[model samples]
Target: MTLDTKKNAFIELGKFLSQFSEKDTIKKKDIVENDLGPLNPTLSQVFFEEFQNLIHLSQSHNGWYTPEQVYFSVQSWSEALTEDNLNQWVGAYDLSAVQPKNIALILAGNIPLVGFHDFLSVLIAGHNVLVKTSSNDQHLLPFLSKCIIAIEPKFANKITFVEGKLENFDAVIATGSNNSARYFDYYFKDKPSIIRKNRNSIAVLNGQETTEQLAALGEDIFRYFGLGCRNVSKIFVPKGYSFVPFFEAIFKYQDVIHYEKYANNYDYNKAVFLMSNFKLLDNGFLTLKEDASYGSPISSVFYEFYENLPDLQTRLQSEGEQIQCIVSNNLVENSIPFGQTQQPKLGDYADNVDTIRFLITIK
Candidate 1:
């Protein structure tokens, strides 16, 4: 797959994925399982846009280049994955000089179709993928694999779903919580793996965000209840900041976040807050409170306020390793949210891992 060739293929893939726009069958399982209950027209648009933005970002952004030049070698790998130069780049690596002949991909299910990039990396690199889909995301992984097969049927042979055995894999790429990483480290000893554990993501706020920016940032925080790695669980605000707009922007989602399980979490947290004498700004549905933990609260969202930049920086620095992507409104050293937080750029890859590089590395 030359760059041009791969680009052309993605163009076609994008075209085909768009056909599902009006199809009711895409959310068939969500409705039947009561996970999504009744699908409203407004919410339907939100769900469809998720696929549209992710697919578009993957194609247009070369998987979204890291402008910070943080992943230099990885960036080159992403460039290779594009439809433009894949053919010329394939087998460009001196695999005989390396040790691994097969690739093991330990996929995560936190978000929909999170492992597709790794799958693409393995197949494009001419290696085999031992994919373990997250239980929560079992649905989207195969669907993506089928999409690739539709594009190049021969690729169907190289990708595999590994259930129990992992030793056969030459190298491993795993994603999980910090606790799970401990288990993975204990289980897969000395196999040459990239194991990613739990990390909190935050947004750096200079307190200059526009109304739309504040609303969109709310989407990132409230979307999926901040269950994602990229979810903004905390904010760095200047002295005397008001959270009024933030509350309003995010309040629209209160009705939709009505799963009994989720609601239980919220109510439980609310009770605890009240019991502990914590103040809550309740505007009918959602509650905002100051919290220390990065994980999302059950019933509402939490953030710790900072009056000074130095103090916030020191705190964040102490917990830097646990942090993931940072969303800012063009603030210094952060990722900016465009529309929704869960919605990523076309070329964005998780943990700054280059899906294209991982694809071609083992080859």
Candidate 2:
């Protein structure tokens, strides 16, 4: 398929997604598929209802995958997959020398639509995709992929969903925990692959942020119940930096703790820390504990003290592989602005690997 044809198909997919909102699963049929230039409107309507059912079913599939969280993922993608964004993202690469290859994706179920970027990258690069969906997130992406195929029949041959072992693929991209990553390395050792492992994001505080900025930072911390690799699991503050203002700023998100799954994690982790005698700062809903770890459990955020900015920057640079993305108010070098970590653009490749470039250069 031509690049423009692929781009147009995705732009229509974006329009189909724009009908659903994170606020609720109330389907809006008024936004017709004709606007999206879909090939089959009747099938599109059926798939639209399936989209709503999948959002509700996803929560039961994984307790952490709430409807609100699933819709938020959908909303982010709806905004990102527009014509201008896709064109600008694809224009950066030279596709004339590209050759289509079979790309296998082993998706992670930590959050909804976590593997969609790789799916999009392979298609936009004019290649076929073989996807192995995680059981936790099995329902959503496959449904959306079907929507894409319905929009453009050309993708039917380009996309395949494999239920068993992945075979007959030219390259691979897999996301999993650190243990699974090692296995992926050994299994796909001879192929051109992108093996992703467990990584966490951190935020830096310089004690000069506004209350609004701090509140937005709360979104970075709590979105998707803090399950995504992009979620800010740790924060670095100057010595003696008071967390009182930070707590007060994030009070608006207190309702997050009311969710039973999150509440259970809060209670359990708090008790474990108390018995272990770790000093913690509590605000009734969440806990902040002083530690040197980057990966914090649910409902808890690890914090550390940094005396010198230069030294901390150097430290983060040396540990770049372990960190996914940093969030701050430009306090550190290359840190993403607060509240934008989850809303990654098309070019914001995970682990800072240029996936499109990887696809272009693959032999």
Best by lDDT: 2
Please, what are the lDDT tens digits per residue for candidate 2 over residues 1-363? 788989988998898888788664455655444234555546645667777878888899998898899889999999999999998999999997888899999999999999999999999998899999998888888888878886788899999999999999999999999999999999999999999998999999989999998999999999998999999999999999999999999999999989999999999999999999999999988899999999999999999999999999999999999999998888788899989999999999999999999999899
Judge candidate 2 against the unseen true structure and give its global Cα lDDT, from 0 to 1.
0.91
Per-candidate total of colliding backbone pairs: 26, 0
**lDDT values, one for every candidate:** 0.58, 0.91
TM-score to true structure, per model: 0.72, 0.96
Clash total of candidate 2: 0
Runs in model 1 deviating more than 4 A are 1-11, 22-100, 310-318, 338-340, 353-363
Across residues 1-363, which tens digit of lDDT does each residue of candidate 1 receive? Answer: 343343454444443443343223143333211121254545445544454444334323331111111122122233434443444444354333333257887877654455666666565455667787766555445645555554555556767776676657777888898888998898777776677888767877776788788778766675555567777766667657788777766666666444555566667877888999998876655677777777655456566767766676677667767777777766544556634455454446566665555544543
Cα-lDDT of candidate 1: 0.58
Give candidate 2 misplaced runs (Cα > 4 Å).
24-44
The candidate that wins on TM-score is 2
